[model samples]
Target chain A: MIPVITAFDRSPDGGKGLARDTRVRWALEEAGQSCDVRPVSFASLRQPAHLALNPFGQIPTYEEDDLVLFETGAIVLHIAERHNGLLPVDAAARARAIAWMFAALNTVEPPILERQTAVLLESDKPWTAERLRSIDQRIDVRLGQLSARLGDDEWLDGGFSAGDLMMVSVLLRLGSSGLLDKHPGLAAYLARGEARPAYRRAFEAQRTFNTRPGPSE
Target chain B: MIPVITAFDRSPDGGKGLARDTRVRWALEEAGQSCDVRPVSFASLRQPAHLALNPFGQIPTYEEDDLVLFETGAIVLHIAERHNGLLPVDAAARARAIAWMFAALNTVEPPILERQTAVLLESDKPWTAERLRSIDQRIDVRLGQLSARLGDDEWLDGGFSAGDLMMVSVLLRLGSSGLLDKHPGLAAYLARGEARPAYRRAFEAQRTFNTRPGPSE
Candidate 1:
């Protein structure tokens, strides 16, 4: 089976590839693996069948043969581990790559998500400005540490791996915040990941999905 | 060569096993691996020596022979991948277990961390209560989903794997929030994980490091 998964019925990003599914799609495309998409509304996602695939009722659960997987990090890692391109062959390098993946999701992404929640949900709150500033500062600290470590390097570790893929995905969330431009090297690094053909393909694919006419439309 | 890493000279948790180092210690104990602990003061963590091992200046980096890995998920996964007890034998089952690991950190822990930050940094902000409520709701949603999926099951996915180890570590952060109590099942689940002998050993080890009198004390 060509592993099928869900995508936003319509992405909040206005068809941008910022959706989590886009990352998995990009990984599959990069690996030359064919896959399928199942567009789901927020309502449909809560239904029993979708929840069965993803307990979190989130997007991009991968299904292949007897294996079913959720959590984009795990799915992407699965692809990276099974295929050759996304992970390094050397054991130490591979471990570091996985470490970066965890760091991206676990460490870097948290503040970004907080910033997003602040923007999307709490914009009208009295302390929105203060909360936004604090969250952004946290992002800046993490980015500063990451930028210092990455200094003048093309990717996180050695060659591009799932680590870079995940880091770029997390960093892309900073698009509107404009905080990324504060560090020219990190900005360039994000651009480099976006420049990948696989990323472009994934972007367009999600864009197409988002733009597709809904039943009412 | 055995791996040794630093702990807080004086833990913010005051030897309650809430420090990040405890997770690493627990994984080590579960793997039945003997390791050394080198306690470091807050002043020392940012110094060049520690930064060389962990660029992010965070806890639980692993050092074994030529390899040094950061990110607790990476370190725990490394131990799980190498050792027998932490992971499973079958391929698909192993992948699912890994998915739970990602879900715990990426999905579950982020909101809890936000709650911590709100209390630590943003508690005085006018919107603190609202911000906290939103973060708590997000956490509760994840827990509700996880608890429903878990549905009286013992461990996530299957017999205790590294995934459970990680999930428990992440859930432990909610100790102060009293959010876990919202779901009796998850509360019980955490209690069971804490009951493990290895977890107790790991807790005591880190407690020893945490409680040991520092020069400042």
Candidate 2:
């Protein structure tokens, strides 16, 4: 059964991959799987209909056959696991790849999200500058560490697994912040991920959704 | 081979399970395994010795005979994958459980971490309150969605798995915020997770470490 997932009718980022749905779309495109996107309004998301598929009432809940799944990472991972392209055959390499995936979301992405939060919610706050510095520093520290490890390496672990997909998606958030430019390797690394045909496909798909006109009057 | 992970010499929370190490400890405890704690000072965490194990210079990196893993979610998932208790035998259920793990870290924890950043680094700023509200509202929305889904359900999915362990750990961050109390089900749900014997053991172990004295002169 073809899985259907939800996305914002219009993303705040002008359809940049910052939206979580982009990750799922990227994964589906990577796996060579075609799926349907169900655009949801903020109000409708809270309704019982949407809530049932995703208890968290978030975007990108996967419904395939009798199975329903939420969480973009999980959905991406599910796609990676079920299909052959997203993970390597080696057991150890696969585990390491999965580790990188967790690191991307759990470790690297937190500070980036904080930066966005500061910009979106606290720009007028008195402590905004200090908070921004701290957030930027934390992000730099993580980037420096990751850069050292990556050290000219292509992907985080073995070849481009779902881990790379997620990591690149995450690093893309730093585009507006300019913090990523400070780390040359990471900057180049993200460009490489974006250059992927699948990524371009996924980006275009979500962009199309975001730019599309709303329902008829 | 037994895995030895690091813990804070004195957890900032004074033994509260907020310490990331608690998650790793919980995983080990639930797996019916015994592990060692190599407590590290904040300075040591930055030193080359500890940095070799975890590039991010964070706590709760797992070290077995040959493999070393960082990121609590990754380490916990690794432990669960190798051991029997934390993952389900059914493939689909297992996928769902793993998804929850991703959901907990990637989806749920990000906003909470953002709130923490605002409180810790931006509290002195003029826009602190505004930023905090925006961040908190984001978290609140997520929590509301989660609360509704967890309504009466004991755990996120079937019998307690790594997913619940992660979900509960993420929810515990809201303790001081009082946001959880607003949703009785999630609050009680968090309590159910804390009430687990394994969770209690993990909490106490971190507490003991945090309360213990440092290597004296």
Q: Against the hidden reference, what TM-scores do the models get?
A: 0.97, 0.92
Chain A TM-scores in order: 0.97, 0.96
lDDT of 1 by residue, B1-217 (tens): 8987667778888988887778888988999997887776678778888888888787766788899888989988998999888888999999999999999888888888888988988777677787678888888999999899999899987799889998999898887778887799999999999999999999988877776664732
Candidate 2: regions farther than 4 A off = A124-130, A213-217, B123-134, B213-217
- Grade the docking of candidate 2: medium
For candidate 2, the per-residue lDDT at A10 reads 78
lDDT by residue (B1-217, candidate 2, tens digit) is 6788988766778888798999999988999998999877787888889878888888988888777788898888888999988999998899889988987887788888878866886677677776667777888888887887776889988899999999999998887897776788888898899999999898888888777775611
Residue A26 in candidate 2, Cα distance off native in Å: 1.8
Model 1 per-residue lDDT at B213: 67
The C-alpha RMSD in Å for every predicted model, in order, reads 1.5, 2.4
Clashing pairs in 2: A125-B126, A125-B127, A126-B125, A126-B126, A126-B127, A127-B125, A127-B126
- Candidate 1 lDDT over residue span A1-217, tens digit each: 7888778777778787888999899888888887888777888889998899999998888999989899999999999999878998999999999999999998899889988888888888778887678778888989998999999999999999999999999999888778987899999999999999999988888888888775711
